[model samples]
Target: MTAIELRNVSRWYGNVVAVNDVTMTIGPGVTGLLGPNGAGKSTILHMIAGFLQPSRGELVVGSRPSWQNPAIYRRLGLVPERDSVYAFLTGEQFVLATAKLHELADPGAAALRAIAMTDMADAAGRRVATYSKGMRQRIKVAAALVHDPEIILLDEPFNGMDPRQRIHMMELLGKLGAEGRVILFSSHVLEEVERLSGTIQVMVAGRLAASGDFRAIRRLMTSRPHVFLIRSSDDRRLAAALIGRPEVAAVELGPAGLQVRTSDFGAFCAQIAVLARDSGIRLRELLPTDESLESVFGYLIAN
Candidate 1:
């Protein structure tokens, strides 16, 4: 199986450190590289794609260093965040050029196949300059996929896509991952990462904050309180009951709803319904406000 590995990888620019001693193994399947802006996600993707070399430690793709290794491109496909397509060339022409560069036997057929995969076949004949931002993103994905590589690296792949385009791209990536092709994409959008990837590598201030299952990581953060927003028939009564529970650390009644902070998430979840039932309060909405990627990232960064 194709895999990317990093061992104490560090990339620095004079006084600035971009990727700071981060190490993780990205195996076959969909993996999300998640972080806020300026969190070194793009830098790591660029280094893995062989656009930049690590300043220290080791970075490898398929057991070989990607830096100064032209052969790595054979098994790797990259859809970069930046707009790198030539506006003058038609979408089909651009993809065909990429296929030719890869020295494919039938570049035209490969380009056509990739264009169809990206749902860009209808607009493939039009010049890239006439396409919308989302269309351009699709064209770029087509060019990247022209060679049918084993490992695909995408940086902010859903940047300009509309809801329909985004859903299609997500489905396409999921399908590719299911076929056992290593797929890694970077995104700051918590919902997108959570919805698409089972595994995520989180970056915070150039360091690897967390890795593996996001939900598992959240569970491991026992020190941080789990917050919830609850709306019921009797908010005041529910709050009064919740404040008396040993599992609940704090409770606040606000205009939105009752915000409950619980040290024991599982315990609180188990008791909330029972407490409501006993208090004769009808439960309306029970949302775990901090059970999201954003909250996890925030906790990691803060710590």
Candidate 2:
């Protein structure tokens, strides 16, 4: 089932457009929403979580309109980007309160379950204000999961988590996803998204850049112009010979080495290896250019 849908959604703040004609669907399983900082990713998440109304398009959760629909809250739980929560209340109290507000039959049992799921049972009696950042994040996720919401929206969920904490959270999310729930989380970290999400929605400059399996997106992103930092015995002769080859598209001499942009990344790499072996050029270093998410977003914006 389609968990969320934005139909040409546009959100504006005075004159600035935060989300521009964005339309996409988030379905079951773990879906990664990706974009650079201030790329309308947060805005999109806010709209889906019913925190912000779309200026011009419809935001729907399942078959019902989500804006101003408190009924959806029963089935949708949101873990916001902001850390602000009921800090004065203990973790157990906070989660119990959410359950009570949801009118769950047994709030105490619900809270206990949530605390255990988050591994915060040991700290359940402590006030949220006393918890560490990672602890607080765990509580927030636990609260979101307390009611067993069908659709869970998380924004930068792994932002401040250590490697171990991140792994823990990822495992929890994986468990929730395996139970056939819809988990949509947003992040800018390339590897993080690639690791957790089976499908990803790429956003760039308030626009939907791409959406598909990670391997397909990787193929698309990795297929284009690639700059290889090649080090050889005779840099000058290697540069001349490389640029002369039909596989290479462009060349630039740099302080570290020559930067060659090759259209055929696979063929260019193979040719370079063979050329180095045959010509007796002592190859020293070779590394693909760093393809950060920022650079990927730049490509989307460029087009």
Candidate 3:
């Protein structure tokens, strides 16, 4: 199976370190490379794609070193974040050119198939310079996919795409993953990563903060308390009752509502409703304020 492995890989430019001793294995199915901008996501992608060499340690794709391996292109496709397409060429010509470069059996047929896959068939004849940002992105995707690669690496693939286009791309990626393709896409958008990928590798300050299922990683952070905001008819009563519970770590009555810090999330959830009912406090609102991917990323970065 096609897989990517980074073992203690480090990349630097003089005094600056871009990727800091990062180590992880990316296997079949979609894996989101999630982090804020300048968190070494693009740097890592470049190294994996063999555009840049790691300063130290090993980086391999499909059990072979990616650096200086032109043969690896046969099984790998890349949709870069930047606009790398020629403005003078029509979408069809661009894709056809990529197919020819890949030395496919039938370049024309491959180009047509790829263009159709990206939903760019209608705009295929139009010059890329005349295309919108979303349309341009689609055309680039078509070109990348012309060779029918086993591994797809996309960097911020959803940038400039409309809601409809985003949905289509997401569905396409999910289908590709289901077919056992190793698809790795980098993005800082938490919602995009959370919605699409079952597995995520989070990067922070050039280091791998967390990996595997995000929810599982959240659960493992026992030191960090889960925060919740609650509003009740009787705020004081609710706060008083919650403070006495073993699950709750702290409770503060604020102007907006009650802020709760609980060590045991599952237990706190189970007891909150019962505690409110017994205290004669009508539950108006209850929200898990820090249960999101944003919160997880924050915690990871903070620590």
Name the candidate that leads on lDDT. 1
For model 2, residues 194-276, the per-residue Cα lDDT tens digits are: 66765888787788888877545544765567778877788877888888899898888877788888877668867987887
lDDT of prediction 2: 0.84
Q: Which ten residues in a row have the lowest lDDT in candidate 3?
A: 289-298
lDDT of 2 at 240: 83
lDDT of 1 at 61: 97
Stretches of candidate 1 exceeding 4 Å from the true structure: 232-244, 252-257, 273-282
| Predicted structure 3: clash tally | 0
lDDT string, candidate 1, 31-116, tens digits: 99988789899999999999999999999999999999999998899999999999999999999999999999999999999999
Better of 1 and 2 by TM-score: 1
TM-score of each: 0.88, 0.78, 0.88
lDDT of 2 at 135: 86
By lDDT, the better pick of 2 and 3 is 3
For candidate 3, the lDDT comes to 0.92
